[model samples]
Target: MTPSVQSVETEDEYIHVRFRDPDEFDTIRTPDWAAHAAQDVSEGSEVRTGKQKDSDDWEVQSVLIKKQVGEDKARDEAKQIVEKIES
Candidate 1:
């Protein structure tokens, strides 16, 4: 699937890049939020999923992109996500 940007809601010092995943329900992989953010994503480029904490609960927190962001660029920002995770 070609990755595309989705709804974004920013507050104070945080910006969320919500990925559009339709079939995410069938596959659930809890990515390492901090590490993924640090190595792959850029600053202010926080990742968020629709997966919930529990069966009937909400997700814990949005994933983060640390140490890579430099002033927010669209193309560079897209490069900071793990496209595939081998389980």
Candidate 2:
């Protein structure tokens, strides 16, 4: 499952990201661009999926920003996309 971003805090040269669901956090040493981008992301706004590098450490592979939409609207859009793909 993808972990939802709960909060982000900067410390030294790393950014600490707290996550929901798994109830854990990871420290990321991101490039300057990514660090700046992280600051603008609101809590609960993005979902992160990654591979574990070691115990208590994760390497973020992708970050997905959540779009503002009603649940029903998102479901309808997903259905439409799936239908198009299947046709």
Candidate 3:
């Protein structure tokens, strides 16, 4: 996992994760994951997931998180995204 850390935010069905590197930064989206998790989510809810810092790149981190969805469902979706990224 990367040492890089970021803040996460969700808007509608979209997720926005921001990583800070000063010179460079990255953001990841999981609309498909959100779609699946959305089924159990209300119109406005906060969903929190987990994030792992990269071992190699200190300025990089991999986060599998979702917001605006049910905890159980959002976790499931986050797991799916993690699996896909790992694959």
Which predicted model would earn the best lDDT?
Answer: 1
Better of 1 and 2 by TM-score: 1
> Tens-digit lDDT track for model 1 on 1-87?
435555444544544444544344433444456345534445445444445333543231333333333225433454345353211
In order of listing, the candidates' clash counts read: 5, 0, 5
For candidate 3, write residues 18-72 as lDDT tens digits.
3443334233233444434433433332222333243232222233344555445
Which candidate achieves the best TM-score against the true structure? 1
Please list the Cα RMSD from the true structure of every candidate, rounded to 1 decimal place: 6.6, 11.1, 8.6
Measured with C-alpha atoms, the lDDT of residue 40 in candidate 2 is: 50
Clashing residue pairs, backbone N/CA/C < 3 A, model 2:
none
**TM-score of each model, paired residue for residue:** 0.40, 0.25, 0.30
Name the 10 consecutive residues with the lowest summed lDDT in model 2.
77-86
Report the lDDT tens digits of candidate 2 across residue range 1-87.
Answer: 333445544434323344432333344333444333433532222324333444654434333323444333333333332223223
Candidate 1 residue 70 Cα shift, in angstroms, is 7.9
Model 1 regions more than 4 Å off: 21-30, 43-46, 50-75, 82-87
What TM-score does candidate 2 get on C-alpha atoms? 0.25
Residue ranges of candidate 3 with Cα displaced over 4 Å: 1-66
